[model samples]
Target: MAEAPTDPSHPAAFWDARYAEPGYAYGEEPNAWLVRQSERLPTEGAALVPAAGEGRDAVWLAQRGLRVTAVDLSREGLAKTGRLAASRAVEVETVHADLQDWTWPVEGVDVVALSFVHASPLFRAEMHRRAAGALAPGGLLVIEGFHVGQLVYREVSGGPPRADMLFTADLLREDFAGLEVVELEEAETVLREGIYHDGPAHVVHGVFRKA
Candidate 1:
């Protein structure tokens, strides 16, 4: 495995190289958790997908009749997302910007979908804040990531190796104190993607609604 970048800029380059291939690094399907939680999304509202690797989930949201914006640090990843959106005949806004530094949309979003967005501790907290703040009243925040216990099932194949980068329900609850928890649970599920995350793994999935 490539060493985790000591400098923050190194991660963009790392992800850019990983997404340089012709196809998406994680395939074209929306994550199962996101799919399962789609029913909870508002029908007529804007959706924000941060750290959206290749627009699969964004495209999926667009198909569900929601206006979507997909954001990622890697230009290459955003390019792929645009291509996929075009191919799918879906109109989606693809933004290539670092989540930690990007200017968030001033228009409150109705839903924010954060899937497997593992990053440094500081960035993670900022992302959580931004995600929660982006939502309008009665909006939803859907998140899924490798939990701390996932290390036992999948070793180091998925998510950040630094334990601090991963999430726990307690951390999420603390970060989203203003929101009402709709669903939060940790479960062992089969992650079917490419060679990277193909196995039974532990994950934390949560849905919170702003009051």
Candidate 2:
């Protein structure tokens, strides 16, 4: 079993184990929500994907014509991402780092898409603020993850072990207040990412645009 996030230490082990499994923990396909938001994803310019696992989303974005950089704490996962990118014949820059401490450039990217990156309350807001700061004007941030309501479905869908680490629409609005709310909502949805995340789950998804 993967270790629960004890950040700066445990998360690396946790994710590394998950990715070292027989296949991609979240599958080889891009996130379904990300695919739905593809029309808005920039076909050019730079894109950043933090907490990228197995490079599914990063490779997809690269195939879409973006110069993509994928960041993750697990070297194993990054390696898988590199392999996946090569299999797709696309280029993706991989960075080994923790998003909580990593400093991204201001207005340095045209797109920032994150999926299932559950942050602890201790630095969740600040992390989100940093994500907002990384966006150039008119840049879009597409994100989705288990909502606080996922607690009830935890056994079935599997999300952050701690409720405090889960998100709500209100919390996201407050954290990313600097960005315009293109779409924000909490809803019940079915997940079919991989062996781990498969069930009817409650999630909060949003698309925020920098003005």
Best by lDDT: 2
Pairs that clash in candidate 2: none
For every model shown, what is its TM-score relative to the native structure? 0.92, 0.95
Q: Write the per-residue lDDT of candidate 1 for residues 98-176, one digit (tens) a residue.
A: 8878888643898899888887887777778878989988889999898888766555346666678778899888888
- What's the count of clashing pairs in each model shown? 0, 0
- Give RMSD to native, each candidate: 2.1, 1.8
In TM-score terms, candidate 1 sits at 0.92
* Ten-residue region with minimum lDDT total, candidate 2: 1-10
- Per-residue CA lDDT of model 2 for 51-132, tens digit only, reads 8989999999999999999999899999999999999999999999988778776999999988998877887888888889
Candidate 1: regions farther than 4 A off: 1-9, 154-157
For candidate 1, the C-alpha RMSD (Å) to the true structure equals: 2.1
State the C-alpha lDDT per candidate: 0.82, 0.88
